[model samples]
Target: MAWGESGELFAINGDDLLTLSLEDQTVETRASDLKKDSPQHLPFSGANILFDIAVGPDGTAFVAYYGNRQLLAVSPAGVVSVLVQSESPWSPHGVDVWGDYVYFLESTVGGRPRWKFWGKDRIAPRVRRVSVGTSTLETIYDGL
Candidate 1:
C-alpha cells in the first residue's frame, strides 16, 4: 500500500491487482483479465498476479505483475494498458517513479550457489529502470 495524491492511501491487492480507494473506502480493480481468451502464443495469458504498485508524479498508477512480468499504467479515468514487456523477468517487489523514469527491482538468476548444502556466497542482484515514455530498459546496477 502506498500514498496517492492528497495523501490518500492506496492499497493493491496481491491477487488481481485491485486498487482500493481509501478515501471513499471502496474496492475497485485497476486492471482486468482481458487476455484470458488469447491464444497460448500470446505473451500475456490474462493471469494477473500483481506484486507492487507505484503512483507517478502525475497521479498515474503503475502496476507490476509477477504472472506475466508486465507493467501497466492506470489512469485516473480507470484505463489500464501495458506499459512495457520484453525478455526481462520483471518480478518487481518494490517500485518508485521519478522524473520521466520508473525504477523497480527485477529478480534475475544471478548464478548458482557455490556450496550446495550450506551456501554462503550470496549471488549478486540486479536493478532495472524503464523510461516512462520510452520502450528502453537499462540496467542501472548489477552484482549487488
Candidate 2:
C-alpha cells in the first residue's frame, strides 16, 4: 500500500489495482487483471501477481508485478503500461517512487514454483534506476 500526494491511497489486491479516496472514503478499482499491458494470450503467464505499489507525486501508481517480472505504471485514470520488464527467473520484487525516478528491486526466483524464493539466478545483484521524465535507464552499480 502507498499514499499518493493527491490524497489517495493505492493498493494492489490480486490482479486488481485499487484506489481509496481518503476524503470521500470511496474505493475504486483502478485496473484489474492488468490484461491491457500483457505480452500475449498466456494461460499461466498472464496471471499477474502484484507485489509492491508506489504512488508518484502526480498520482501515477507504480507496481511490482511478480508473476511475469514486470514493473507497471497506472495512470490516475487507471490506464496501465508495462514500464520495465525482466527476464525469466528474474522478477521485479519491490517498487517505490520519489521525485524524478521510480526506484525498484529485481531479484531472482531461483526456480521456485510459487514465487517463494529470492535467491540469485546465477547472476550478481545489481542496482539501477529509470528516469521518470526522459524514461532513460541509468545503471548505477551493475556488477561493475
Question: Best-fitting candidate, measured by lDDT?
Answer: 2
Candidate 2: tens digits of C-alpha lDDT, residues 1-144: 999888888887766999999899999999988634664422144445677898888888998876766788999888888888765545665788867998887664333343333344243344556888988876565431
lDDT of each: 0.60, 0.72
Q: 11-72, model 1: which lDDT tens digit per residue? A: 66544445566668877665555233332223234434566788886677877655565666
Q: Which candidate's TM-score is highest? A: 2
lDDT of 2 at 80: 88
CA RMSD of each candidate after superposition? 5.1, 4.6
What would the TM-score be for candidate 1 when compared with the true structure?
Answer: 0.67
The TM-scores of all predictions, comma-separated, are 0.67, 0.77
